[model samples]
Target: MTQTVSSTDPPTPSSTRPITRPTVVGAWHDRFEEILTPEALDFLARLDNAAAGRRADLLAARRARAHRIRHGEDLDFLPGTGSIRRDPSWQVAPPAPGLTRRRVEMTGPVTRRMTINALNSGADVWMADFEDATAPAWQTVIDGQLNLLDAIRDRIEFTDDSGREYRVVEASQRPTIVVRPRGWRLCEKHLTIDGRPMSASLVDFGLFFFHNARELIARGAGPYCYLPKLESHLEARLWNDVFVQAQALLGIPQGTIRATVLIETLPAAFEMDEILYELRDHSAGLNAGRWDYLFSRIKTFAQRGPEFVLPERAELTMTIPTMRAYTDLLVATCHRRGAHAIGGMAAFVPSKADPQAAERALTKMRADKDREAADGFDGSWAAHPALVPTCRDAFEAVLQGRPDQRDRQRDRQGDGVAVTATDLIGTPTTTPPWITLTGLRTNVSVSLRYLTAWVSGQGAVAIDSLMEDAATVEISRAQVWQWLHHRVRLAEGLVVTRDLVTELMDHEVELLHAQATDDRDHRHVDEARDVFVETALGEELPAFFTPYAYVRYLVDRPLQPAQRPTAEDLRRSEVVRGHEVRSEP
Candidate 1:
């Protein structure tokens, strides 16, 4: 199903057509066609036509703000939104029906098998992620939506290549389904309205809400969402407005859609109170998205000097002054506004092959959960199903008989947990003793491995027993860039240089090639090197590597009219795209 499009002719626009007559741009699959009907495409078109302009404006604003920061403009809280934060009387909407007891939550990509497993993973909530946790292949995106639709109907099941069967439990035993759509920055190139790509966020949300909002509501749940990578309160406001219009379009109640914002970016941290205030009607809570928060910090202040250059991802613990301020402020803000405060992901995937390692991972997870619980977090995220009980036990100890600790508002006025602008920036004035060669190698290895899997339509990869996502790769490559930019000194007093990084990357690439099981793996290893070097050593850092890589590698071509694409075709496109494109390291 490799669609060969004429570069001379792109998808055509249908702006003058009726709402029911929008055109879908990519090749269609029969399975996906079941969920991506004309009605669904029309709904997405309506959403795009309505809010796409605002989305573009906001993105432009982001670029302008980044330019200001690059020119030494300081970042601080918004004076314009002061009254909303100062008004002590306002609160977010009450928790939606099934989201009230989220002591432990599981998140993963929405493959058919993963979907069934996550729903039965014994957690209070299952966040079916189409964002960082998923590779944005055309088939992967639509298949995910179909999986969720089938799961909602209790007809979803999977049989692996080894013939192992997977199925969901009875409705009474399933976790609450909450979808995390693609961020606002991404566009669904496979689908378009008026020849313009629609926001991936709206496409994911539109199809899911259009189909499942009524079904979820009928079953005592609502169309709950987790908004990711929002950098400002205004972004949250855009999502709130989308939620409002989505509910109304489907004839559902205004407050039926609930969303939790991931305060993962540096700017979003400063505006946590305002973000909640904007979406108060449909807000669920704010999550301490630790990895992305760290990545955001580095990206924001990468040029600010060695003060902001992080040593290693593992060294930046949650207990650091900056991280503590973030969590403390998040808990306080959510509780102040009657929203649940969710903690960050415990991404330690347990290994049965090594009992001692599993125990160590569990112990670290226990400590992390205990800290969040003590800090008054209502719930937290687990990347693996095995760690769910451990997380539950940690929170259970603190929760006692209560569903959540939203009642335990650690307010600055009363609890003495004060967080300032300086604390949020969390820059260390002093330099570390040394950066290690092992850290550099680890970054290269992990980034390469993760990028390989990502190019193959897998987003969440378990490497060295840690669940790694796009944020993990972002931090990995960004650190290399930051280290090179600062000429960071190693433990042996040698300054890290671009040549040194290239040498190490070449060695790692050779090592991976030796371990390659086939030509396909070898090519991925090669492309991984290309993507890493391009992103890490470029004159200007690309905002996100996924989108650039996706357009260049994941898509084969435009679909022929009435032609059906297959999963195999999508997989082949990755290899085809890899072979056709080459970049210098």
Candidate 2:
């Protein structure tokens, strides 16, 4: 039964109006009211009221599934959904406008500067991400909405402290904007409905859709999205339902929303066909979210045994058998259903100062994109603007003036890649002595550094020349837990113990302190260390590190207002030319 909201069908005041107005627990920021209008708050409240129960049920199902996997249950393609996979005639709706030829997609947080940079990055799509790339402070969320609105209206611009301006080009040259909302597992503590924190996923999607769906459609691009961290087909179905209700409430066409689901979690990998089927009417395709997929693998089977233990992070390349099977199956499943198959991110942040380092990074990025192209991926992701050309060139070489290769069905090739359950879960031997002393230290250092930055309201940072986000941090900490839990022996003959991990963490913190530029940076180190210790050395593996850290550091104890940007500060940063960015700053 579909519950549609219309003028005739009034919402229950108790459910729709939780209080006199939507209670904003977060500090008021400049221009937040522009995005969080009374009408918008009501819409979010209604959406949450309708979807909360189902979200809770599905999350419970996830916990149940995790418990079963923890005990003995193995993952396989659902026997019940075999018919859906067997049915070859079904296909997702044709690509929506501006989404047909996505040769390269640039992803970043939705700050004012990033919004300008990504639109001008020359990628076919700009994934303005609110998930891994964003720290999700209250102001950040509101400002992100404002930035997207401004970008859509061609009113966004930014200038650095050096007086260098960044502005969006004319709409003709700009990439299509695709927003990636946060996942289901987190909540927005700032906004509460019925005396509880609202679902972060709904808050993000609702605010964006409510504010931009119709405007984007009028601009010849519908509300495009990249769905992340979905663990099952059921979760996809929940999103489909939300889209239906949202479109109906807004009086938009039913199938206007097109989404590309990131097949990042292990369970989602097994149900790719089902996930696509669930959102078939609105499906764009699936992406190889390699980092979170690795994290999911560790989280799912960490205690199962040594066979499931993976090698160090560096050794877990896309070419590994398990990883190869994942991508091959993704390409096969997507193409078979007439959907595009996108590739993972080339996370290298190329440096021009050191030509050798830049060349090495570009060389690696080119190889990665080239491999994805050959494997039938329609497009790939670039974290930085410099790598966009590399990604596009790779797809162009294979596509050869073509838009996408959905016609290239890898499943029908010679010997027809028939991936099985073992191919995905069964660990492969990749030059043993898995846990090196250096590997442990690197994980500790990287996780601590990233967490410190994250607590300071930076979600994505370039660490060791790679763009490290929450997904990468999850992998880092989760790997440490797995190694410590199993008491894995390092290549240097030191077994992973709590004492050893503590010593290494202290050493890493001291190293960070030595690198700190100010007292604020030093304070963040202690906070970040607390976060690292809680998540990495816990008795039981926490599903995610962000929720707890976010509440403790961001929500409950907010950053000083001075540290956040003001609207006036942003206004003074840039001077926009008429429908074009100034060539000179």
Q: Which stretches of candidate 1 lie over 4 Å from their true place?
A: 1-22, 428-433, 557-585
TM-score of each: 0.91, 0.91
Give one digit per residue, the lDDT tens place, for model 1 in 251-366.
Answer: 88888899999999998998888888778889998999999999988888787778777768778889888899888989998999899999999999888899998898899889
lDDT of 1 at 23: 59
lDDT of 2 by residue, 445-509 (tens): 99999999999998889998999899877988999998999888888889999999999999999
Model 1: how large is the Cα RMSD against the reference?
Answer: 8.2
lDDT of 2 at 331: 94
